[model samples]
Target: MLSTVSPRVADPNVRTALVETAARLLAEQEGLTIRRLAHEVGTSTMAVYTHFGSMEDLRRAVRLEGFARLAAHLDAVERSRDPVADLSALGWAYCFNALANPNLYRVMFLEAPIDAEEAESGGATFAPVVAAVQRCIDAGRFTSCDAWSLAVQTWTMVHGMVGVVLAGVFGPDEMLGHLSTMTVSLYVGNGDSRAAAVRSLARARRRMEPHAPIKRSDGAAEFERPRIQNAAP
Candidate 1:
């Protein structure tokens, strides 16, 4: 039911207009100032002040909205017995959120004026990820009883790569390639290598190369995988 519903946005509302305008303006040059944002949204600057109290407040709202959308995405994933796959999916979901909304994601993290409490509270947005890691621990698919730590570590791993790739410093293919092995390392230290997580991540599984259909060392499982071509340079 959560997935079935979109974020409850008040249609044609002044607050949404101002905040949404702020996010878009951030993506373009010479648009962040309140005067330009108001003109672009066909409203007076007073509306922005009235709606958000101040520019800093508007920035914080935009940042939180980005996390809110990501929360919607993580909530949408259907729970299954394949804990590794779900984890992989969440990583991809994290990346997708960044890639699809580069401007919003950037403000949510790099530019937002939120305080330490707001920053710490951002962890709650990833509760679904923590729950998935817990599921892996419960199913004995992963080691380490501290799912919270694993979840935070994994979130850090994925988000770091997302930031790097978006900055154009890292190629998409190279970053995505590292994602599997790096995430696998964490889980391996916890239990079995989660390269098998890739199989369920069709495109990523293919991107893993000749190593696709990774076999368990115990010969307990050999998963056939789907293929994917990474983004071209």
Candidate 2:
């Protein structure tokens, strides 16, 4: 039997516009209404319902969009013989994604409620990080352990720091140095020597610096979030 498709298929351009607008509204702490959202995107109010079913569904879509973009960034990090450096690069990618898409990042983790399948999709996005952790174990940079568990621990450490910076506890300029220190410490705690961890992270940072965001003297970010295409859940 052929799979059934929904009769009300959404235009990808409109979907992208709606999701991006919603994320930005959330970041700016503005109220979201179907009418306002539709007006912002030059569409009818019914278009919101036609595309997303309801506002709650739109929230879920926005979260999934965030994960999709994160997955893309993580997948772009090149692998190398040095597993520790590769792992560090993955961490940097995660950080960059969060920084680049603050509104979507907040929606992904903080604002919205995700259903069971959506939750699974979010986990799938983290697979690259887990794979990097497994590489470290395979190379004996980390002790034999559950790579998923180790990845979770390392991920949460970075996430907490990101949250702090996002909340303005620290400026963006200060985040990289603190992140470097924390990342090296986590690697050392896992089994790598401190010196080796530092060297590995340095390698990754050097590779990342060319593309990293530059902050203006007034604290505005030179890097803005890219418009991401929505992935099917």
Candidate 3:
């Protein structure tokens, strides 16, 4: 005889379990609706709303989590000693992150609506890539282009390659190594002159940072937030 597990125990752990179950189902199943998700997780729609606000909010949270994870991968890539190699590693990390979490990646990069104004305002979300590019500049590895411009150019190259690979425009085996080399070469270049602007911008950002605090919260000490210029294209 199979034992039955009742979900309606009046326990906080039960409620937490329900929310996690629902979140997992959402990630696994694309286009999941609140009602369907509620049923699968053995909870009510009200429970989902209580935990996550709205369906849109839940989606946003999921995408935000994905971006945070991707950011961590990029961060690790940036920590490498070799600047050129770090950039290449970052490109590889981007592709790997997207491929590993396709649905989450779509929600993070493709489906999430990015505000043009927020992007133009140089929001916090774009800081990691900007910081990475700035490092290359400071090291005299790249030309001194503005951080924003270099960030956009470098990001575009990586994003475009990922898009092509995901869209099945190229076979998996054919593009991986070739694209990685090509992307690194494209940005760092055959000569050092191309990166002059990059170095200058990095220096400028470092100098300017002391004057501007990016965000403030109630009763919290003021701190400088890294400025990430809009590179979303």
Clashing pairs in 1: 143-190
**Worst-scoring 10-residue span by lDDT in model 2:** 224-233
lDDT winner between candidates 2 and 3:
2
Model 2 TM-score relative to the real fold: 0.85
Query: What TM-score does candidate 1 get on C-alpha atoms?
Result: 0.73
Model 1, which residues run further than 4 Å from truth? 1-17, 24-31, 116-121, 171-174, 198-233
Estimated TM-score for each candidate: 0.73, 0.85, 0.61
Give all candidates' CA lDDT scores.
0.68, 0.80, 0.56
In terms of lDDT, which candidate is stronger, 1 or 2? Answer: 2
> What does the lDDT read for residue 229 in candidate 1?
42
| Candidate 3 lDDT score at position 121 | 27
Candidate 3 lDDT tens digits, 3-117: 9997643456544554444445554555568887678777778876766778766665565566665676565542655455455555556665665555556555665474454
Ranking by lDDT: 2, 1, 3
TM-score of 3: 0.61
